[model samples]
Target: MDGTTVTRTPKKAALASFMGSAVEYYDFFVFGSAAALIFPTVFFPDAGNAALVMSFATFAFAYVARPFGAVILGHFGDRIGRQKVLMFTLVLMGAATFLIGCLPSYDAIGWVAPALLVLCRLLQGLSAAGEQAGASSLTLEHAPDDRRSFFTSWTLTGTQGGQILAALVFIPVVALPDDIKYSYGWRIPFWFSALVVVVAYFIRRSLHETPEFEEAKANNEIVKLPLGVLMRDHWKDVLRVICCAFIAAVSTVFGNLAIAYGVLVGLNESITLWLVVAANAVALFTQPMFGMLADRIGRKPVFIYGALSSAVLMPFYLLSMSQDNELLTFALAIATFSFGYAAANAVWPSFYGEMFSTRVRFSGMAIGTQLGFLMAGFAPSIVTGLGGVQEGGWVVTAGFTAVIALIAAISASTARETKDVPTAALGLTTRRAQRVEAATA
Candidate 1:
């Protein structure tokens, strides 16, 4: 608002963000699926249950690298432009994913197979650190203040689309006979990411920078060191986001850990994969609705409801899988994931982005979320190690999920409401009050 209205481009921004997120996460989730189902057998055959643990550990490696990625990618995103960082992340994720499909297993390459797999996964972690942060920052800056959550919701809804695609692709691959499933079928989904990346790259290339970033540029307010500014003035918001982001553990638990548990309880692998697909597919529709609801009401209430409800509902969902009833398992999966947790997932992009000025929005969101997501990246391995995957292990898993949710809900409760804050004065800058007054005037 600095004496001028910023022109917004919500639609193109939303589509580009959605498609890029879908493509990036499609590659990411394909790796998660493979880590859960394929890698233990192919890469670490001699280690028994330990093989599964090691495979999940490799999945965690990406998260370990995410904070570093966030620092690097977030710096450039805030410094250069959201568009350029997004392009780099897309290509990096695609290349790493495609290479994962081409890696030789232990039998073919000895210890080098797992070593190479770890290297590729580290690259994926770095790319993902920036993917959602850049996409959400781009979309939020392009959207009108009143409809920010509604449009930015597409960034996460794209994640749902990605999860759905990953599960759908894995369904057939899991159904293949043992030899083919272990060998060639699993690689197809990873290779498919190459096609997705190409399509998304062209679509994303058409979008331009946000008006807000341009306005910041015109004012000569772009920071030379975004991380330094963010840590100094916005440390509280960053901590809050990290705590609130713990809610992400709900997803990794539902998507990755539950799938493994479902198989142990006699459910077919295809059915387990379908359960994830069904929940995420439903979330694709429900998340946008949750985002709209946040716009109508508030982000805090919807987000808290999501965290608390998912905490309350997760035990039943996990326990249902251990029972003889497939219907209950599917129903609980949708209830916990699609209906309960979807609200938080849908709203965080806008909620978190609105917490910082344009000068450091990308770094603030990327660093905070990626740091918190370390727990998500390692949730399955942590839970499995804590005995959450044993015969009566739903207790430990549900308890762990509840603790994480509690921390997130409490953190979200402490944030100042940004729903009414204008796009021009979204962050905690020294001029924020003056800008807010001007924006409201």
Candidate 2:
């Protein structure tokens, strides 16, 4: 009872989550861009038509390590705390990303180059698996009763900032001469993550634990085996969140495949990079606005609307890419990613975290989201193996986005709306109602 109010913690926790996620996702998204644009030549030179496939396969290796990281990190987060796990993940990611920059190319080390890249990528995945879940859970637990959705929305706003930094940094690197570009330009971005690592570590470390977790500790009700508790008590919620997390595949299609497709079709590369920058800039503004709207209205309407809108908008955007009209492409890109995608992106941290109690929130979110995002991790390679960026490839990719978006919409519909739920009783309706009545009186 000596702790700060929920209103104060939400803003502080959201800021902490925002900075931490910005750093982690900056490392993660930059690699996705590198995999699409540069890795084929540097790491997989011998594969001819299979070079892209090989590049994306290397990208997918990280997803393989994520679920395992989720289980291990999530256990400790629920047992010890959220802030500690986030700090651990940040260090792990920073080291892996920096090591990636040091990897020798195929010309220097032959096949060992790609293998080392895969090993580092797995470490990146392991770090990321815990980053979002822990951050989201921390934010959600600290948020005020009526505005949980709005506060937790900042966790995802951090991701848009990361994407923007990733694209902006790579924009220049893409313009470098092949020798310089391949040799040192790609490495610069990875190395720069050290600054983010240092700044974010200090910001996150200054924060206190969430009130919900603190309360759970006071009651001696913290679960020892959080994954087991999550499985036994909240499996349905986990499954639903997994389905919802699959919508993340759309990001790979847009960010990674769009870069590959634009280059293959003879469009200018800078334009492609700027497209991501522009869309994310719009999202930086749009996501928080939508989050506020979710607080006023409800999470489901905004979430479902976003999923359906993204599913519908993907075709227009992908079709516009075929026409080679930069204006049309930018317009459609902004519409699809910033407005449409931000709808779901802004809401999910609150929506998904509210589906479980604080006792198992981090474990539940990490395991479910890591498993679902594994599908997203491989989407670009799968699309490439089908065909590289033609209309047929676009059609297949669009269909994939629509199906997953629909699944996310349906999954969100299954959860109870927690807009009015108190932070101390997020997954418990009766206790929340009693708390609200007591507060109101």
Candidate 3:
């Protein structure tokens, strides 16, 4: 391919990204749902009152593995190619999820069960650390400059799709008798991931590497050490992305923590799952619209609006669940999550991907977001441990949500708008680009 004349495959890239992310997160969210609704009984049967907390900790273990996975996978993704690395991540996640399904429960394995669960969860985290960063970078590079957000938004829309699928699958599982639900029903979701993985693997395999990465390779601009370059040249942006990524915690608060809280407050387990299903189903449509809005206005405004709106609306959403009004709770769930948090979710792929050049975009986005996502991964356990899942614990959850949202919004306010920036010229302010060129010359 000519360095200056690379073919963009925006639609193909978007479709591949969507399928890969949907599959990857489908596996991931299955684990999340299981942790909340099933794992305590199956894996931590002896922990008594601590079983739920331990299960949530197992959920947090993936976040712990994510940063390390980010470094290792991000390097290969930036060095070799996003498409290849994404293929690897899909397979790794599928294998781990499948193995989780195969693991013996605590009754059969004693302490070994939860330990194995954590190990599989770690592998899931490692795979996830790279999935979004690689997918977003690939899609954004393949996109037309003016429609970057809209195309990249599909990557995250895939996540909403996955969550919806996970919830839908789990709803039936949660409805089974306790013996059956615990013994076999829960494993079906994990096993189902294998089929989805095969489907995503073929779809992603058919797609080519992004044009920007191809152009960079053609011009010999591919860095020998993407992480070194990322940190030395883009540290400020990395830090900014880390803080802005805090907004992701809002998602965990809604998806996982709130589920436990809802059940504690007398909502049916299936109804809580339906809340997740409804909210994410709405996000499937709204996020793409938010992406278009960002394209028209700018990423920062949309992102900041998402952050502040989530903070303001979260308390009401949580409080409604306690009011015995399922209709009101569902409405608030849609408002807070689909309309509020989904804006940030849809935009972050582009917002963060634009903060670095093609050479280090993968590493920068993977590392920063993974590190920030530690907050998200732990939000359920941390909040629950702090009594957020107890009676009247919505206050703790709401306060935690507000703090993270404020931090994200404030961080986003300081970012330069990149909606108008050319794809090739992204991550390069004129002065910095000149400095880099001068250093190379």
Candidate 4:
């Protein structure tokens, strides 16, 4: 090592983002799992079918709070720093999740049971609204220029880790007798999040603000009312990102609603849990590889291919559930989710984060993606209403996933190719193209 050439590792930044996001997502996924598994019976007992819808509805309630949290937290992230916002999101998510674990069930208290759950879910959503954007922006800013996708990919890879942990932790709990499982098994996952919160806090708190943001601040060029600046200067990119983010609905269909459908259609509960665990486990390995590929090839082709392939793959996975073939179902699920969907999942952090400069990246990403994610967060209720996952059903649900994935691919295609462009030249090509046309004239 040359003494004059000091070297620092961006892996530490990636690790911090990864671990913090994993902890935060652990809290979020636990609630989502419980909503599919336990909340329907415990929170809405009056009407059996209505109970499932209500449970999914309560799951969607959090998204209502996400846009507001995005605005408030995005302001702080843009003005103060990303590190502080990341800490705030982690603590808020833990507290809300723990509170959900403590809430009285419908058997103990009637309609109020779900109402209270709604309030806690809202808090969880708010915390989550800022978590991804902050983590991705921080990681992207810290990474070496050529390695932006690789580092920001860790932020999403953390989410796969969290989902894997959530599924693994729930397996034994789901095996407990009905009384114990309902009373304690579900709550165990939520309470465990408190421990993760403590670990994530110490790691996240020590992180330094990104050099890019520091440079912007030192130069007094930070945007005022970043939301406004984002809308005025970058609304087209924001809209494109919103459509791209909507593909997240594929996740809700795969994770939460699939569990309900599997149970409804007679797959073993343990098998269902293992499906999520296995898929996410595969994602843990593949996501980083996909991200590195994005760094080399471009974010667009990888993401587009992922979206379109998932559209084709969803039917196979959904149809597999109707048969008694556990092994085949598992393979199809892993193929669709880990290899196909994970491509878009790994690429999007850099793909989206690169669309803006550091000055307003958080607000631009948070508001746009959260608003689009509102559709994803509510997909369970929507699909259920459509009878997409009804008994002896795969057509409606398959079509739903296919349509959303197609929209995402189209949205991605419309955006300018951004592979070799530096962070400084994110959304200026249209203007530059116009200038070239004028010069030719």
The digit string of per-residue lDDT tens for model 1 on 73-176 reads 99999999999999999999999999999999999988899999999999999999999999999999998888999999999999999989998999999889
Count of clashes in candidate 3:
0
Model 2 agreement with the true structure over 262-304: per-residue lDDT tens digits: 7766678888999999998999889999999999998889999
The per-model lDDT (C-alpha) reads 0.92, 0.87, 0.93, 0.87
**Model 3 spans with C-alpha error above 4 angstroms:** 1-5, 47-49, 432-441
Q: Can you write out model 4's per-residue Cα lDDT over 1-441, one digit (the tens) per residue?
A: 122232334787899999999998988888888888888877887555577888898999988899999899998899999988999999999999999989988889888988999999999999999999999999888887678898899999999899989999889988999989888778888889899899989988888888777777877878778988888888988999999998888888899888888887888888899999999999988999998999898899999988998899988998888799999999999999998999999989899888876778999888888988988888998888888658755777788889999999999998776666655455445676456346544
- Which rank order by TM-score, best down to worst? 1, 3, 2, 4
Highest lDDT model number: 3
Scanning candidate 1 in windows of ten residues, the lowest lDDT window is 428-437
lDDT: the better of candidates 2 and 3: 3
What TM-score should be assigned to candidate 3? 0.97
- Per-residue lDDT of candidate 3, residues 103-191 (tens digit): 99999989999999999999999999999999999999999889999999999999988999999999999999998998988999999
All candidates: CA RMSD in angstroms?
1.5, 2.0, 2.5, 4.0
Q: Candidate 4 regions off by >4 Å?
A: 1-9, 427-441
Model 1 stretches with alpha carbons more than 4 Å out: 1-6, 429-431
lDDT of 2: 0.87
Q: How many steric clashes between backbone atoms does each model show?
A: 0, 0, 0, 0
